[model samples]
Target: MEAQARAILEKHHDNFLEDGNAVPAPARRVVGNFNVDDAKPVARRFRSIRPEHLRKAYDQLEKLFQTELIEYSHSEWASPIVIRMKKNGGDIRTCIDYRIAIQLIKLTHYPLPLIDDLLIGFESVLWVLSLAMAKRLWAVPMTLWAKHISVLICLLRHFQWTKMLLGLKNAPPICQQMLVNCLWSFVRLPASEAAQMDVDGLAFLGIDVGDSAEEDLSTLIEGMTVFGRNVPSSPQLNSVRGERPYICDIGYGTETWEQLCVDLDRRLYRLRYWGTSVSLLKNKFGKKRFSHEIEADRIQAQSKIAEGVIDLPSPSTLRDVQPFLASLNYYDEFIESLPVIAAVLNKLTDEQIRSGRDLGRAMEALRILKRKTVSTPLLRGPDSQKSFVIIIHANPWAACTVLGQESDGVFIPVHITGRVLHDHKFRYHPAENEVVALIRALRVFRAMLAGTKLIKVYNRYSMLKWICTSRSLEGRCRQLAVCFWKFARFSWMTMVWPQSWELRLPPPRDKLDQNDDNIIQVTGRVIQSPPVRLETLGPRCEGWLMSFDGHAKKSDRWGSAGCILWELLSWDVVQARGSHFADVTVNEAEYHGMIEGSKMALVRGISEMVIVGDSRIAIQQARGLIQCLKPRLRMLLSEFEDQRQEFKSIELVPVKRGFNAAANYLASKI
Candidate 1:
């Protein structure tokens, strides 16, 4: 036992405590002051104490009194201490709970410590981040003194990240924020062997820096130096004394971002500094911003191919369609609604575009759509840290989806994919076509889509619902549904419907049907369908923007219809109505109103119209998708069909309920 004791003493010979040795008072006395003149003071009544615990508590009190940690108090202020078991469960600890006294004590603020002043006497100062966990050695009875230390600690933390005040050279802003938010405090100790030997001298007053401090510190330093470089000796930047300027406060200019790019490029050249590259740092910090490396490549590619369609001549023969389509196809990923815009071009092949007026109009529309697409923003590359939104739109003729993301609260396109489903095998119900489009999009962009959280947006509510459900699917649908489940296995996936972005979806990408063969079976089971001869007006085809509204009072058994047309060229709004239509439901009334508007356009020799309404049922019915089961509605649909034939082309689109306020007001007056 004696040898064991000697060995332990030998292990910590420098740390041995000597008998009757008092710790010397600090050279500078720590003073605390509070402006408590306006505060009220109170004294608590002494409560009955437990006899056994009282002995332990009184013993602690006597020790504190003897050590000058506490004194006999005849003042009005009195706070009690409680005896509690220590963590080891072998000893009692006296804890002074100052729950009430702290509140009554008036607040005080300490001026921030000056770093240069703090280091005035030292030749060279080193920052030692001690990883030692702190332990309170003894409990001192509560007094006005201890509160000052608490306030001092708060001041230290408040100014921890203040760079100019802290005298931290070459620290980055991000590192400053991280250090300020850290759960640790700093202390100053004299650099000596004796101080180093004393464990408490190096200890943190509050939370301790854990084992991860080394890694954290290294990361902070790396972040600080990632963009660091030597200052140039410019005469304009130097003082008259030829000394370099000491810029303590940071101010950013437009060139700051460009400098960051240059820094990143230089860092990348070293290869060892790649860990601090923009891409890696974004991954490290989970910042949903573009990576410097990937965006550079994408921008370069865009600039190179931007002029592919610029020199193309007018297409008079089938030979010209391929070159135009190829140029349009090169930028397919930036365009939304590509299938709709290029429907005419998609249907025509080298053998298909015979001399016809429709072909000429289709070619002209293709050129207009292509020009619009080129003007859209460059596609952003996929980001792992950011959540993506895939917008899918499909009509009977084609299907498409666009990948997008919300960055800095603005949604921007990432990639677009779409194709005209000229093949019969790919054709399905419009609802099914929408789902197929989503699945196709997911498959094509799986490299980017994988492991990213995706929000799927669709214009058709039915399609969104069908994709979200797993049951009642069969054959090809079941297969597509399986792929969807796999797609959802990404980091996360969500569904959003009928999105009209305040920042709209990306422009349309024109895709041909023959491009994708992966969806086909080995046995050539896929059949080709004759292109649906959609008698649609070209984009250049002059059309009026028509709006219709219908009103009905079931009790009165009467309905009203109102129509308005804004001429495409003249911008003249022509209004028309057929009110007091007897024995017609509101839905039938809406159909008649649109038909009356079309007839009005026909009378004015307008061959095309893009009709808009707030009624989804009416719009879908007019598009020949929804069946009119009611007798009067079916008769009105027949009459509407007859009027629709009088024009070269017509489109019925649904608007929000309150969108056509003028039309609604006109209908209500009837």
Candidate 2:
């Protein structure tokens, strides 16, 4: 590759640094009438050049004058020119300020001409143009005639050579070499004026004398239509010119598929299809193909290290103890309660401390870590054709999410990730933190999801509204929102409710009371998974009554919600209360209470219910009597409406605090 690149650069080396030859006058003559108005001359005073660089600048100006590239002018079009240091830091170069001259000239532009109109004029004499160009430049030097003959050559190249090369219908070996050589020599022409040196001053008249015409435009425009993969196979182009040997199958009773296999085997001895095996297939997909059976070597290595650490004698000095602790720390993710169990051993390793432990607690932690790792199930690799589903859980200090896909009628895990939210000053709301979890997970697995369908299954159902509708979030949350928008724009993505039965790997049932650790659960489990709150009712209940209430303290640190259900048949009442640290206002709290109340009713298979709340704003918003202009309130309102879909009818009624006393008392206590 490096040698080929050097050869290509050497081929075009003459096009670079030149002898400052001025382009001939014929190429510069504009072939159009200058009927547009001319502007008055504008002038500026020239600034003093730097004293040290004045001599170098003067020498450069003298070279330009000698080459006739510039002439002395006494017009009022003067502007300051600066001397700039060369890129190699060896010398200074002279530069001109053409701003005043540019301002004084009134530019003329013609309306864009249609290609069909020009093609009509050339339809009768296409061959005449090419022959005329070749005849005119036949006797002149290659470099001298290269510029003046560019317009004629551009027309011939675009109409003749480019068509022959792209269509793949020409006699290949001789024609390809001839056309390639002709185009290669054309690059030595004056490239700087190529774009403006058209047949006429009208640049958009379908005539481009630019280097791009000889180089890139033909390939770009002909890419899919003429030179694409599905073009019919030509023996001259593919077999002879491409240097691929032709293989023929002559057997009498063989099918085409059998003949292909036989020919391949004869030529290569053994035929192998790339990316066919399990390992190769996994690599082609570029996903995490986690499996214990396939990772036996890695597991064996870790097992040996663990056994060695276990058999070693207790360390008397800190140096001897450090290596063992380091080895155990590497496997901390698999260990449960690693920090508390290894606390004494970690203290012993501190540089200034001389104290030590008996290695009893460390041994327990290691044994547990080893056991857990041995029992851990291997996850499958991601499939690009399959849709991706992300299950997320978040809290104030930490967040976790699992990437999985449905396989064999089950949702199997592909990867799991979590991290501590270390930015303390940002103070992300719980919903915002959940959004952070989602964005972090999507970014981590972006490659696997490039053009795939993605579905986000969220624990906090209200978060779906914030992600899909709210446009007012700022700072890190807004950054996350943009990342989501980019992926959402190009891919098939949806935010939907998470079914209760969808959780296959629930959060650890044993860690219900360990809330202070702030450990993010990769699985869908919480602190004492709350049971479904069902309204206790009498037999054959006729109707249902819901009492909704909300609460906010004077300082607004947290908001509380309460809802009570009454079965009218036997006058039985069931009460439920919850709190939201993310909600800032009392009205938000009231909407949250109404949302949860509707959810409880839906879960109990109730068709209709009456929702009674103390906050008039919450009641009016739910009843569509008022619009919630605030972004967060609007999102909460959307969540309430989505939950309303599960019920036949939910009527909202506003009541005074005294009339809704039971639910208000429950909200205040929450």
Candidate 3:
């Protein structure tokens, strides 16, 4: 019967081998009981029906079946009618048991969903095959047949069927490769006995095995563990040194599949032994959860080691020397004693030390000497009699010296070195010695001038003249003279004369303008004051400016308002003030206001600048500390930085209240 079916298929295949439009005579002849070929004449009855016309013919056939004129049955002879309909361009109903054909083709071994997904283009063929498989009417592998049909459908859609049928059209190389791979995937193996197969059979269609052919089979067995037989026992397997047993049918050709299957069986045996060994090891040395107390103990030990509180012998040190070595906790004392120990050791020659019958006794003597030398006190005075002075170098050439005095009135100088000024050079001046003496004298004078007692100097005019002349001394000497006079006057005010007394002194004035050739006039109002109470102002009042000048054109007009702020404040906070000015741009104006406000705060010795403005641009700019980018604003920015150095700190704040009344008033007047 199979041979007969093959012959019939071959004949039909030849008929549609060229155009694919011609219906097989044998198949069409069995469509209905009526001998249409004989009655209507072959030429007329064999006329190919167009697809549109086939629909009408199918409807008529449906009517005939409904009227009981035709029967639908599970018989191969009944398939001829469907084939005739297909030949006539009609939609043939899928066979109810088409899966039987799929089984015969050996395509059922694969997962059905995978097969379905791969055969989406050949849905009709798959449907027929699925029906046959579900009904057990076919022994074919439904998945395998569906895959082939999918390739055929793809080819048919891409090229003319007529050319394909005639052999004039060739199937793509991929389609042929897929068919060969599917065939290899279909080969069956016995239940107990393993079969050899190629790696390609298990791989997806169109994939090449390449150098990973062996690995592919191993991976396949590992993935399909449930399907494989029990593994063999071996020490290699137990140690995970051997491959697992699982066949990978990943390539075409009979030999490849056979080799793959052989590899799979061997690998599985090894994997089984490995799994068992792993289980045994795990059971023997399994991890256990510790109680909180135990965990805490472990953590404490770890932290001690990390912090170097617990000493572990150094890994790089000689093992024999480890026992004799002391803990590193007394590092300072240990280092201090090393030189003394070396000196004592040098006195006794190595031969003499070795000659000592007991090495321990010799080592003990050396240690005693080291301890005595290092433990000796360096200072030999009472604690109250000790004094130290710290000299902090602010610049390479200058240092600020602060002295410490003992109860006996002895002064000691302590040198100060920090990361910032370690490499700095300071030139000691004679004035430093004078300042030190003056500090000591001031202390003694304060003690003698207790209460409101005042002693008039024998030469008061001469002393005043001397002090005034001393102030004119240049550089370090000049600074020293000023410090002496200031300290003396401060002592007088606080100790000698309790009443308000003023020494006649020159009034402070701005340095004469150096650029007399290009003098420029500036005009502005007193827009703001230092943000501090008068009594709280203290020594800072001397640096504060009463007003800021806004000039249109000046020799220093190129400078930024921000830079001017820094110059006036003498504080680093000026950098934090966002300010700039440009050529009449709104951004420039806003930036200028922000910077100027910050500078005003610094000049007033205020910790914060509260900038209040109705202009949204100015408010946002001030709030964000935005800088102006206009070319004209660069100079303003420079000026702001120059003026910022006077204040200790400055902060920016936005305000909507009348607190900025002065600034607002100035803006209006401008």
Candidate 4:
């Protein structure tokens, strides 16, 4: 602990040394820049005033300092005027201590002893003020006493003289009102009655209010503007100065007044600084006004309407369509002035352009329609019965058309389309493709509902791509929502593969059997074997199996046999791993194989795990149906039990089929 303390002190000492070394030269440079040499004699002469007058000046300086008119730290020579005046009584030691405390307080990095001492001094003054005000012994007005208290707080806070006015202490209402008035006066802004009421006087100065201070100040300013009369009186008020004084008096001395001016200047400087940065800050912090955004949106909607009208091909020759195409350019310019329409237009390209003559005719038809008309005939064929009609829906975003037929009376539907497009030159550009796809989908869905026997074509890939990229559509699209739910429901499905079948043929022991023909027969037999089999053995068979066990009794006491089989017959198909017949208990061997298999599945990142064991007891134990009796078996059971949770879904099933291929394969290998 001592070493730790030493290390911390050493670090701080180094920092102090670095700071102290840099201070003197800079201080001298600052004093030199001010050219204080000529003023030194005048200051010295004034310093020798009679003690009574000097004390008065000192009191005024103290009040001004408290009000923060002039910063003592920034004054020439390293001492505050309050400390310098104390030397007049020749109390050299006290004066030196006061000067040292002031200097120490001025060092921003140093702890402030002077502030603490000053607070103690202010506490004594507060006692005096309380007694004087309580007794009504002083001739000063209650308002004047409050104003002086306000000046004192302003002085203390402004000069970092927090010691003299600790934030924890509360001042009288008169003092509080006076202080708030003084601060507001420096702000060069009028105060509303509500603001004056809410200022709560000294409460504003107590404690660090953080961001709320700024908010409260802003509220006060806003209230003043909303409720109070404007400054620098209007023309009508110019003739009424005698009746209504321009400036009202709030109690403050000359020193306090000077300090208020200085404080006001500082505040103005800060406000200007903030004003200079407001534009950049607004770009980051202020949202674009909804009115401007909505106007842009409306313009875009109009452009989409115009684009749909102009893009339809003419029924006449291609040459006739040229006029309509030319007219589209003029319409485009007019629509572009509406920012919303311009935004949508900027997303268009040549590939999306349809027939201009059809669009122009559609627009002309819409214009000619009466106020009550729901649909307008746009294009009339030679037969007159055949015509293309534009259908206007109440919704601005929904408008469509029907292509007419003559004999059969069939009308093909045409829907307005828009999309967002991207180009390599400008990646991720917002074009009209998405909106176009949405229009097509809506049209198709509508046709389906209307009992139209039509195969509705849609841009499926684009829709799916949008669904995958945008989270907004994920909640709305049924197909995508179902896919996500399925993925989550069967989490284990992601980690494990379903069962597959593989033939297990033994290696040929004889040279003749090693030939391809004989090998094929063995392989065929292996493939033809039943998937599952249960064998009952006599007691003598157990000893024989132990003799054939290639491992030692204790060492081979626990062993695992595994086989992989594919479920080909059932819809709930799966891959299975299990153990075979052996000297070892089938249950133990099966459990071991399952544990090993689960680890492999985890490594492979399978979302589900399935275990198929021939032993009902083993399966029941795994599912927590039967408890293991032996400690060793219990330990193995515990380890193998929780493999299910590693996957999204897990299931245990018993298979009776000779078709249970995985277990059969394992038994045959044994």
Ranking by TM-score: 1, 2, 4, 3
1 or 3, which is superior by TM-score? 1
Q: Could you tell me how far off, in angstroms, the CA of residue 3 lies in candidate 4 after the best superposition?
A: 53
- Cα lDDT tens digits for candidate 2, 1-670: 2354344334323222222233222211111111214444333334446677777766765654464434444334334454567646669865544333333233444233232332333222211101001111111111221111111111001110101111111113222222222222211222233343233322322323442333443444332321221223222122111111101111111123333333322211100000000111111111112223336453433455445544666555566657765665444433333443344345444343335444444445445444544554446788988887776656555566677787765666677666655534137666777677777778887787777745646455467566566665546456655677655442323434335324444334224214323222222121222221223334565788888888776575578888888876775886575665553678878887887888788878998987776787887777765557775576577567656765788767676677788888888887
Best by lDDT: 1
lDDT tens digits, residue span 585-665, model 3 = 443454466556655565556653323333444433323334444433443443444344344543333434253444444
lDDT for residue 92 in candidate 2, whole number 0-100: 82
lDDT of 1 by residue, 59-149 (tens): 7555544655434333444444445666466578655433344444444332333333332332221211111101101111122433321
- Per-prediction TM-score: 0.29, 0.27, 0.15, 0.17
lDDT of 4 by residue, 1-670 (tens): 2354344334323212121101111100000001112222110101123454555555655654554433423222222222232324543211211212221121222122222232232221111100001111111121222222212111222222211221112212223322222224323222222132222221322212232323445444453331142333212112111111111111111123333333323322221211111111111111111211136333223444445554554333333434544443323211211211222223223333333422332333323221112122122232332332221111112112122222343323332222222222122212123333334334433432232222222221234455457754445466535433422121101111112201111121132123223212212211121233223222232111000011112454644456453322232223434443345554566666656666656666666544455556655676654556754456456555445545676555545535355454554465
Best by TM-score: 1
- Candidate 3 minimal-lDDT segment of 10 residues: 129-138
Candidate scoring better on lDDT of 1 and 4: 1
lDDT of 2: 0.46
The true-versus-predicted C-alpha distance at residue 608 of model 1, in Å, is 38
The residue-level lDDT of candidate 4 at 245 comes to: 10
